[model samples]
Target chain A: MSAIPQFGNWLSRRLQGSAAASNRRGYNAARHTDMAAEVWVIVRIFYAASLMVSFAFITPTLWKIAIAEPMLEPRWPVFWIHWVDVRLGATVLLIANMAAAFFAAPLYRKRWPRVALAITFFLSVALMLSRGYVNNSFHIWLWLTFFFAWLPDSDSRASLMDRRFRYDSVRVFVWATGTVLLFYTLSGIAKFIGAVPMNADKLSSVAPEALAHLVTKQLMISGDESVFGGLLVQLPTLGWPVYMLVIYIEIFALFALFRPALIPVFGWALMAFHIGIWFFMGILFPMQPLQVLLLLVWSPLALRPFSARGAIEQLPLLGSVVFWRRTKPNVSLMKFWWADEWPLFTVIAALTFLDVLPELVKRLLAAM
Target chain B: MNASHSRKNRGAILPLIRATTREKELDMGRKNNRFKAGFAAILVSAYTLVGGYGASFNFPEIFPFFNWALFSFPAKIYNEWVVQVIAIDGDRLSEPADVHLIDRFDHFGAGEGKVLREWGKSVEQGDLEAAQAHRSLFENLYRRSGAEQVRYRLVLRRSNPVQRWEHGTVLSETVEGEFTWVKDSGEQP
Candidate 1:
């Protein structure tokens, strides 16, 4: 009986030691993940800074050209230069930034310089301002790229104007909501004011009449019916309601930012809205892209809970020999798959190939 | 054994510190990411909405100040008027209508007839002789055919109105008594 008691105590001590070791392992793993994430943030910041500097130099000149020249002049040299500079610059920067994020292991070893960081931030803001006054669609993308590039890292402890930037997520949510609301309100006002002189009775007909005439003239010259011609004709009576609905959607989307549950619904609606515009009006607004980014942001948070539950439910399955054998049993897979040590060159090469394929095809076709 | 225990303690402490730092960093990172994501969302949405509006309306410029208020409607009006005038001119040149008759008078008033009458000395030099000879020929032909005043009413449609103007000197010759002239088997007064 004494031997039996001693054996029971020994088993208990062994179990306790194992639990402590497991806890330590888990802590170590969590610490490593945190470090990796910090590195990613720093990489993103540096990339953003670089892009901001580039944009600051380029955006103003582009703006001047876009404003001064007719948009559809069919000037080949102008078109080629603009297309290559804008699209290539943005794409290359995005790839570089993402690569930096994936392979942030080196960044973790060193602290980012405050002066350099501040300069980047200042340049980004300056780039934003250069085109903000114009309210061009391109500016939105530029601003977003800048914003994502400089998004605060885990280690940033500095306060803005001596006020700690707390609840940054909430602030972002509020800002997005407010901005969308403001835009919606402004748009509604512009339409209403513009159509006011026509009187209520003729107001509905005004846009249709104007659009029809414009379309007819364009068709006479080009022999191509505009995408919006049919829709514009059908929408004469529903103009005011349609306008109001657009405003409502914008405002509602802002609200959905706060209540993430409504996101899928709003996101779908927004997608549909963009598709409708594309088909009916032949306008490719950046709303779809924005929605995609929003979905990406919410993905980690919303999917985390469900995934956690799934992991818990499959804990027994994870312990099975089949699963263990299929995975690297002898080697720790986690150690081999450090997030910060991803091959930047591979990613860059892959992206380059993907981006260059269309151009390569075109060139080959031309040569042939 | 003591040194090994101390080393283990250090290892444990390092992990705890790292974990705490990581947690703080993650919290801050998440906050910033969230804020930026939201800001970006709003900006992009606004941009799209504005772009859609500009495209649909065919605003002269995408900017609010340079839109329809500044350019499009005015340009549209100018283009419409120019097109209408061009269409009218094209219609006139393609058909033979009252416009051709007006063109004839326009040619007579503006061409050789005006110069001859204003600068020449006598009726022959002035082209008045040609007009008189034609009038005399027409009068003789009418008299030989026994034609009198040919009465005609100028009718104009209500929907298509025409304006006419007349200014001329009239000559009257009065006879005190009725005189009969007999020529062969015909008598005319």
Candidate 2:
């Protein structure tokens, strides 16, 4: 019996050794996979960082102008030159480029989307540099670009892209949170420290005059006092709450990115606040749209784990392929699989062609 | 029979050991990844929050040279030196008069001429000098009026030439010259 037990132990030891070798092989493979993912994340992050820095500089430029030259009268001729047309064109181009990247990321299985995205990125930088006008509108584009660029797509999960994306996302979240907090804390401190009276009676009486002056100084050519007077009368009753809320929101915004549910609520509140300012005070921060986009795209911590898992699971296929598979789960009926998909591909190709056609025409016209 | 059985048992044990080791390695990797991510998050968050705190209270106008160690010290000095000057000069007669108060005249033009033009219609004709004096007194309220440009035409002949002053000429006319200083009930100057 003793001899038999010894023999059994020996056999078990040999089996264990073989299994250990197999396990080591699997571990090596997983490590390699993770390293590859980290590299891709890094690249994506670098791209995001460049875009963000470009955007930050651009935003401040607009603020500087607004502060330096408070537009008392709407210079319509200069408006198109300074504010509207250039921005519209840049926004359209950026949106189109982003759309293309989204579509092409999964298709073609090439780096063209990266190149295209990079081009759009550069275009945004150029727009900021060339365009002097800064407002909430420009900010919207910047935030939108940042959000979309950070989305967990195929490129982001690629070995070279994962670490970059992770690092960049963390960095961006920190920067945004820091900025909001700074604004909030400083505003709060100012209100508390500055001798500006915060009483309802004082605010009601004083705020309207200030608002009127601001509007007359910044917007209306005639320097209409009535609009501001009306707002002042109404705002004083509401202004204190709004002022308090502004501080509250900024401080709270730091946590909103982590808590996904709060984002939509906060986003709506911010939009309402901005719109109210625009309508009543004629003060608009052009970057509100970008902020809204950020609020919408900010994934909640609860959802992040699932999304991260999904990203891992969806790694084998490109973003478009995953989207297509999800959208058309029952498209296995055709006799010829590739033939059946021809219609979809054709539509996508047409859309793609249409998108690039304008640029092509412009280029051709320039050449001629 | 015994040897064969022993060999079979050994083989089974070997595979199990290998499998267990693999699981342990994966667990370690997952733990390490989590630790790094957590560390990065903490670093980013702390840095951002602290930085933001610094930025928010850095408004120049409200807290000019406000050091945390000597909060409100600058304001006190400013009030004593700057505000006192304006008060003593009776420069607070203007609608909004303060150290940082921005007047329209400063931007467009400011001097005896501009002051006279603004108050000329408002003041009684007999009290024109009084109005001028009031204006001059108000002008002395500010530390210094920002610079202004002056333009004049010198027509020596039919060909007129315009001379422009970019730096601006100073308004040094005395308030005493602009208005009659009435004797007070108690004393006369």
Candidate 3:
């Protein structure tokens, strides 16, 4: 929280035409152009491959969707899912979804082509949400594909030749970064607000039993018991410190977008956090870590090798040290007014809508 | 973009080292600014609409919009629900074993485990609606498992989740309840 202003100041100093951009003499500009071409390809491949990896999560539910016997009650009661099997031969549906992922880059050019992808994309969503199959990873990856499609493919057109790259690549990169951070922050808000002192009277206290209950239930439900998970739940406290660390990482994750070195820092922390959830409970979200690999690790120009620092620039917290001794980054961030401001507004509203306000609404409606 | 001017003040955004496009970008200058703003606004609008009290669409649970709600509620109600589906033979119940019901639902099986835990709670509270719904679900599982013609026992156990092992008691948990879904012989209790 304290370092937020510093990141903003770095962006501000450059946009305000301060001494920041003047420090560009430290590196070569041509190499950066070639790197963008490489990064452009890497981002797309990483994303498409993530879709293929979703097979692990998707495979087990094949029989559930295939059998035509719906859940006891569908989560949303989507008419087709509950009544008629909307996914005709869910096996065929799975192949279509995987095919869409592979065809994404070639298909996103203009009009007639995108429709083919959209049909398959929506079908994947239906398959994912059917038979009580709902997961956070599914939602995040689906949206990433949607938002990332809007990003420009300037690398193919002209190799970051001039102003076209910002209009194309930079804008969407920032947009995608801001959008994902919104999701993480919203989830953090949901967890954080639960432990607020004012809400302490509730039977479900987050600090004491959030992990105990979740760890126990997930392990029990999944039938994948962990000795650590069992021992942790029976402890004197519910490991609130670990809980606080997660909330802090998620809420602050978006700020990593502002500074290059910070991306991998938050990226590593988030990936570790996701793995921690798997260890405690049998749940696994292969996409979250994979997506983090795209956004923070491989995000264009995010932690792209520092001219002076070699591959060390890609390391987690240590990467920030590459920027530490420098006067300023040779690579200045272009001002993204709309992309920058949306996250601030969305995060506040997401917190309000997800937590306290809903409690207020439920109470108000009850009172009336 | 002035080639000479870009040579002097190169824009370091995006691909990091392009002076040539900087001037053209500045010259074109926010042509789609309104479009960008509107798109951001639309995303925020759609987001707020689909949400509810820790869930989505005013339903207790919904896809994608769900918060995963870990630790927000008490998990003690059903710490471990393996749902032993044992068969009943002449005056004897078959040996207890885990039912394949977990495989029938949940991508990772935790989703079904979580629900059966909820079912256990609802059953404890005498939730008739839940029973009606769960009866159909279990009947489907029984039919799929080919466990007809013999009565089956659905037993739930508690693992003493929050408490420590008292005096090294290996048997910390006991069968909390039993449910019967008799297929034939008109034998349900």
The candidate that achieves the highest lDDT relative to the unseen native structure: 3
lDDT of each: 0.33, 0.35, 0.52
- Candidate 2 residues lying further than 4 Å off, grouped into runs, are A1-123, A126-140, A143-229, A285-294, A297-368, B1-189
DockQ of 2: 0.03
RMSD of candidates 1 onward, in order: 29.7, 24.7, 9.0
TM-score of chain A of each: 0.38, 0.37, 0.68
Give per-residue lDDT, candidate 1, residue B96: 23
C-alpha TM-score for every candidate = 0.32, 0.34, 0.67
Cα lDDT tens digits for candidate 2, B1-189: 699999999899999999998799777755644554445434433433333332232211111111111010011101010111122223334231322333432321112222333343225344755544434333332213332211111111110000001122222212222221111111111
Error of 2 at A335 (Å): 71
- Native-contact fraction for each model? 0.00, 0.00, 0.25
Per-residue lDDT of A188-272 in model 3, one digit per residue for the tens? Answer: 6666655654433243445555566556545544446664686676673656667667877776565455445556667778888
- Pairs that clash in candidate 3: A162-B21, A163-B21
Per residue, candidate 3 scores C-alpha lDDT tens digits across B1-189 of 889778655544444545557666654453344445445545644553444454522324544455534455543444344466555433344466566433432233444444455555567768867654654454433443334443444455544444422222222345645665544222323
lDDT of 2 by residue, A64-127 (tens): 3333332211222232334554444545545645554554344312355545664554454444
- Which regions of candidate 1 deviate over 4 angstroms? A1-135, A154-181, A192-224, A231-244, A251-253, A258-260, A286-368, B1-189
Error of 2 at A238 (Å): 2.4
Model 2 chain A: which ten-residue window has the lowest total lDDT?
A15-24
